[model samples]
Target: MIDSGSTATRRISRTSLVVALALCLALAGCGDSVAPPSLPIGSHRAATHVVAPGETIYHIATEYGVSVGRLMAANGISDPRDLRVGQVLTIPGGDRGASIGTASSGVRRYTGARSSRQFQWPVQNGVVSSGFGIRNGAMHDGVDIAAPAGTPVYAADSGVVIFSGTLHGYGNTVIIRHDDDYATVYGHNERNLVSEGTRVARGQEISEIGRSGRTTGANLHFEVRRDNVAENPLAYLPDPASSDRISFAAAGGS
Candidate 1:
């Protein structure tokens, strides 16, 4: 888990990739006060869900805030390939689905599921304004992608939108809980296009660029958290493109 005393240091990285971070009170910095709307990830009991076309165990488990292993165990699903559209499976936990928010206090445990899917750039065009590490007197847990205000922000991978609302200092934010304890944060958004509990495809438009909270300018505060611990987003993002790709510039430089 991310401690309040996490260290900070400036670091620049290579270019031509698409990893991410955020400047929200939930992950990085905290200031200001915005009353966010209540998330609608209503209770999810030990219910049964019928499979839909193009659905997989990953997306299904994410939607119910449960892990694929748990779901498979509950329903005795041996091979994931055995699942077919119109098939029914039992959800493990009985009628209690908390909105998947930051891996903060009172967070639920979700283990045993991993995504093999690849990640892509969330923004069409941007510059690496900041890299992850210690910054000022606090830990800059995520990177900042500099872009024009209103630039479309897409999902890094397919997963469930566990939290989509404003938080103190984050102006507006959307947090998606991907497979295998992988969660991505898109903060300081001009607007959030998706809602909590909504499943999004890889590269799907989720928000827009904005200088909502404590930021130097219009940028997307992106973060990829592993089991609540801050990680270097650039490490997982694919190599940046030739011209209009997300460039790391260099490591230990941003």
Candidate 2:
């Protein structure tokens, strides 16, 4: 038979042991890890994104609810196809509506007046990666047509080459003065085929597409100006749906 006092002591000791075990479990000292609770959706958004393999600018733009042109402008990206894996892109603030004008069927519509003069396509089988508009709080004076390097750039209309050479942001640029104070510009060319003061006809090859002057990939920056004021090229060129239209991906891609 055990002593009564000794029996009480053993019971106390057992109770103390159970309490210690409970404390250990509560403190998570037994190697059982717990996952962190996830935050609510839209609670937080990163200001920058690291590009991953096979990630296109269009995909990122859609994911962030921003326009492709805005995203490119924010990052100084002239060509969407130039996006590389591991590249860091700055995420611009505001939604798609703030960055781009009203879009229909994923293409931004130019609400401004169209040009009265008609013009032909500058690059055949090219993709219009960026359109003329206000982007990143600044006006993008031209449309960027993505094409393979060395692709021929044609004259939009019959005119005389006014300027042919490097000009600031435009590399190997060729400017043609057309009738009625209208002009066309072809920029970011591998080489200028026409010299200044040379006459060129409509559809004449003027330059070759290249990734020169503030660009990361091969493309042609085409612009239409009247009285030195910028105008939307889409308004002057043939509709992309027409048979004579320059092949383009309205959704922005290579």
lDDT winner: 2
TM-score of each: 0.54, 0.56
1-254, model 1: which lDDT tens digit per residue? Answer: 11122233101110001122222244324221110001211223577888999987655654564433445657877566678999988875523342222212111111212223346778878876565433332345566777889999999988877678875565688888777667788888999999976889999999999877666678887777654544445555655657766654222211
Where model 1 places Cα greater than 4 Å from the true spot, the runs are 1-118, 248-254
For model 1, what is the alpha-carbon lDDT of residue 106?
A: 18
Q: Model 2: residues >4 Å from true position, as ranges?
A: 1-114, 242-254
Q: What TM-score should be assigned to candidate 2?
A: 0.56
> In order, what is each prediction's RMSD in angstroms?
18.6, 28.7
lDDT of each: 0.58, 0.61
